[model samples]
Target: MALPEDMLHFVWKYRLYCTQGLHTDSGKSVVVLETGIHNHDAGPDFVAARIRIDGTEWVGNVEIHVNSSDWNKHGHQYDRAYNNVVLHVVYEHDGVITRQDGTVPETLELKSLIPVHVLSRYEELMRGLHWIPCERLIRTVPTLNRSQWLSRLLIERFEHRVTAIFDLLTRQRGNWEETCYIWLARSFGFKVNAQAFEQLARSLPQVVLGKYKGRAMAIEALFFGQAGMLENVVFNDTYPRELQREYRYLRKLHGLSPMDVSAWKYMRTRPGNFPTLRIAQFAALCLRSTRLFSAIIDTEAVNALKNWFEDLPIASYWYEHYRFDGVARPHSVQLGKRSIDMLLINTIAGILFAYGKYIGNETYIYRAITLLENLKAEDNAIIRRFSALGVQAGQAAESQALLQMKTYYCDKRKCLDCGMGLQLIKKQ
Candidate 1:
């Protein structure tokens, strides 16, 4: 009997097929080493691997399937990438296949050996419900194992974020620090103002900011200039007007054109998080700290770095207003404790990966792992939902999965590919 589709993933995940020795349709013995379900973005669906084939030990990358016909279904015969596939292992036997090189690839069928209970359990997990799928089963899984799983998942999560960083670095011609600075500033603006901040960074340029380093006025000019907020508006408030004048002079000095303030949107934002205030807050940090990136890099103590960020606040003017002309508010636009903690985690993790790649500093890698473990998990809406499902996210791994679900699967509407979806389908 054909295995249920819900259990297919479990079978694939655990590589359960190899318990039976590898045998081709002709009954010739084929020595098996390992097998992996293809997980690449653009490739064949599965790989049946072996230690050796025809006297060549460690023959790599064999394609596999549930039946011989799926090879044609997935259109692998025409794709050259599948040419390296040495053996074809299927669950059902029916066809003869030849590679472009004229070597007839060996095929094996695996229909009888897989356990039924495994499939049933997977089906149970995948069943849809009024609330969360596998709600009861998640609680039965050991917390320690869950934590380890999350740790691995969180590292993978960071790698996903790093891919974007790599793209930014490439755009900046491989200046890691500059790219880091721009990304930090963009993140500070959050999703609402990210594009504006990016435009600001591109307009003013980090090199210009370096020239005005340690001076809040120069920093503000660069920020406002790039934001396109320092146009010909005549404001009576001495600070706003003075900054505009300063930006005008600086724009001329740098031979730069004026930016369109229309590009810097502030609709629907709370005054506290308005782009103007956030930019000013970033400018203040740039002025207050020289060697900011270096300080983060050299700090062995996570608490010390956390304390530094906690103590810093926005400029006095920003403490009173969310916009250029908003009524004064009592609170300062400083980074929150939770936000600071996130920054520390991300920065430390990023530096750890960089140090590992550049200087072979495994210590930084270990430190990054330790810091993530010590920190409390972020409590966001998605995490809260997972908690309602009885999958409490108290550590990095669960949080990572939650984040991955939110960013990738949920946003992309690819629920079919998600573990949660698989669990729900199995439950049914």
Candidate 2:
């Protein structure tokens, strides 16, 4: 059976192929020196490779293919970029590849050199249908290996999340505080109303709300009004009615347009997690902090950071009601520790890491990782599933990594690319 081209790259990268009497298709003795850096970008499979072809030290790129004909099929023969390719490594050498300048590159056939077990193992992983490709074999991998993989995954997750933050920052003209505010607002919506909350934030910039820094009522009015939650609703209660009046004045003054009220979701949502309650809590946060991003950066302790999101001094009306015009019923409007941790994991860490990368400060990046390490692991379906499979995440850091692994690697079945998958397949 034919194997994936990536398997050939993996075999070459790890030197899993046998080296006894290795020779190119043209009968030139091949001695492997450095395998070179694996290129993820365009141009070559591996770059800066140091290979001695029959006592001729050639230091250049190496291209891998399942069949040698793929080079011409991929049009690298016509491209001038492939002229620097020192060696063409392929599983099967069928056709001769010549560069545009009539210089035929040396080719190494890996079919016989690669161990049969390695190919079998890779095939098994590719064909297996399990929770993960190596679900049954995962326990064989050492805890140290798993931890190392998770650490890499954590960084991957952070980088992936930071890409979005950087894009938003660019749109915000590199305003970190504005980006933080918008990101935090999205996190407050949890998953259900995240887009809606982001829309509200984009509609009303943080600087506009910054004007009413210390005033809780004014901030709530602007948030609720811009969210379109306060429109076309008659309230028997005094607070929402007052919010409506305040928002009308603020809306006209700021010349702002409110998002459609339909954007906010309430069905199947808990009372505390309702968009109304979250908006109130978010407004309270705005009322409490002036420079939110700076506060996040300056705070050292995890508890101190948690305090920013916990027990926000929201309007008294929110404590009694989850929505506008609702009757008073005592409920905890305060964010639970878990909710606070979610915000820390999703919102705070990302912003910190993105800022670190933006300003080229490793301190914020270190601080971001440290914050996740200090927090407890989140209890979600993804974390729970990994825990059930004997991979327990002890901290938010590990959980975050596991979440990323599950989504990007496991779900996509990119087993050959995963560390755990690599380890499991390599095991005898």
Candidate 3:
């Protein structure tokens, strides 16, 4: 395994070098004045650093490496971005380097500067087979730091979701309603056939559904027909024939094409999660609300929206059968409470977060935060694993943070970059 350069960057960034005699490879008198701002984007590791070299102050960027030869290995010698680097900081000075303009900057090696304990802790973390390397040490981190890290993790997850929504919004020409429709349709698929459901939405845009708004039959016809459901089944019930006829007329009138019905997953699926019922339940929501997505985004108080999705009435035909010719289940097809929560967490929260971020409005973000905080924490494998290690998630917000932490940090074994890893390894 390669030694991560981030460790060297960290050491260089915090001025962890031995201060008794700090000088460049060229043997110049050097004194640290100020370390530059750490830059995450393109260009340098740190910018605007002020350093006194040979009793003269110089200001520019700072680059870091595990070995001086990495400077050439990374082609920084030819890159113009390195021209402004005032210093080349490395762990070992194996080779010499110069700027693109044929000038040499000062070099400081951390081979004698870095402490032993940090390296020991880092190696220990890399050897772990535990759920997380810091699982045993997580509880010792101060409550305030842990809380702040979790908050930051949750925001990271939220921002990731927002970026995805913005990509869809851009493809849809900034149409929020269509993006919401596509998002909700995918959520309704519940992760199994989400792609198929999204294709269904794109095949029949929300504007098509808008033309048939408040007309339950027309909505059903368009939704089912575009789903490739109405054309294949022969039903004894009057509703199917009516839908078939209506869809045939509208399909030709609007030049509509239905998706392949085989795209939906059915084997081993629960009765409640049948695609027919989900589509009907979603269509019912469309019929009930004049503008479903808009109504959700415009709401101010979280209380009014708590039970908003509970009582959606699926079409009567859905109650009798899960498929077109399948035997009746003898039970009503109504949306479940968990399904409502799924919508809130996946669709509503995602859309509101995106809208807030896109326009720089904090109100929608606040509403999204409140809604998630009110809900119970998710009970998946990741959450259960974190819970087993004595980290309790009291709300969806914390659960989201745990997921981000586990996926992004623990799995990657970037303990060197984590707060827990820092506190656990720091010499006291």
Candidate 4:
């Protein structure tokens, strides 16, 4: 099998090849000092690398490739970014490379230096057809290393969420509360109707809902009306009929239009998880607090947050109805414990971390992690698969890390970038 250039990068990055008796392709003796920092941006592969060639010290950037000709093949020969390259490293030195400045940098080839076992292990992982690339070999990695990697992946997941939250905040004109409202509303839809709920929130801004403050019926009217659920539909129940009337008045007053009712999903969905019930539950959540973001920031205890969602005063009409046209057997309309935990995990924790980053407060970040630690691990296909492989997640934090690792690393075949894969590929 042909090796990817990334394998060469991995080998160089981790010093997997023999470092003794190194030399350039031109026969000049080479000595490694600092490998420098790996650059992920648009620049050299590695920056500020320090090395000595023929007893002379040089410090600059370093570029890696699978073949020496890749330099010219990638047009780096004409790009000024390669002009300051102090060394050119390749797995196979197939051709001579010249910089744009007409200078030939020293080149080092790793074909004869890298361990055969390392290549074998990498090939094995690359050929893996298991749940994860290194699933068969993951048990070889120490538990401590796996835990440490999970911790790192958890932070990575938080950072990824923070990036999204910050982008939303930018669009919301730095209004944290509005962003929180939009995100929380989306979370209410879970995975099935998240986009539709987000559109509803965007169509009817939080300020529109805020005016209704203490009035439950008005808030539900705004939420259900803006969702387009009340449009062109006759409700047999008095509550929805009243909501329809209330929404008509509010709609004209605010000059607001409703989203397409088709935006919501119902097929294969549980009656309890219906969008109508979620909308009603969200209205109740709104009634519990005037400001969503402030509530997230002020609430300290995990149980308190859970209780806040659990104790929401969902209207009696919703207790016996899942939709406007139909009534189901009476059931608790308030969000269940698992549902509340999911909300905390996806909505509250991410915003808390993002807010902490925005305000440079470590307390909120710590609090976010603490909240996840207190929640049960999410039961999902991904978590179950990892458990079958003996990689159990005891809390939401670890489950979230597993989710991130699966989506970003396992599914993408980024084994070279994963700590567990690295451990499995590197010989002891």
Question: After superposition, which runs of candidate 3 have C-alpha atoms over 4 Å from their true positions?
Answer: 15-31, 40-43, 53-56, 72-84, 95-104, 425-428
The TM-score that candidate 1 achieves is: 0.78
User: Which of the predicted structures, 3 or 4, would earn the higher lDDT when compared with the native?
Assistant: 4
Clashes of 1: 19
Question: Model 4: residues >4 Å from true position, as ranges?
Answer: 76-83, 100-103
Error of 1 at 330 (Å): 2.3
Order by lDDT, highest first: 4, 2, 3, 1
Superposed by TM-score, candidate 3 places the C-alpha of residue 338 at a distance from the truth, in angstroms, of 2.2
lDDT of 3 by residue, 1-428 (tens): 23478876766666655665788888887787888998888888999999888889999988988889888888988999999998888888887888899998789877876677767666677787687988777877887877888888888889989888999999999888888888888988988878888988899877777888678899888988999988667877788789999999999999999998888888788887888888887788777764667888877565566556667756777777887767775886876666777678778887888898888999888878878888788878988888888788999888988888898999898876776676676644
* lDDT per residue as tens, model 2, 242-357: 89999999999999999999998988998889998889888888889867998999998998998888778888877778877776679899888889999999999999999999
The ten-residue window of minimal lDDT in model 3 covers 300-309
Candidate 1 vs candidate 2, TM-score winner: 2
* Global Cα lDDT for candidate 3: 0.81
| Model 2 lDDT-worst window of ten | 127-136
TM-score of model number 2: 0.94
Give the range of the ten consecutive residues with the poorest summed lDDT in model 4.
1-10
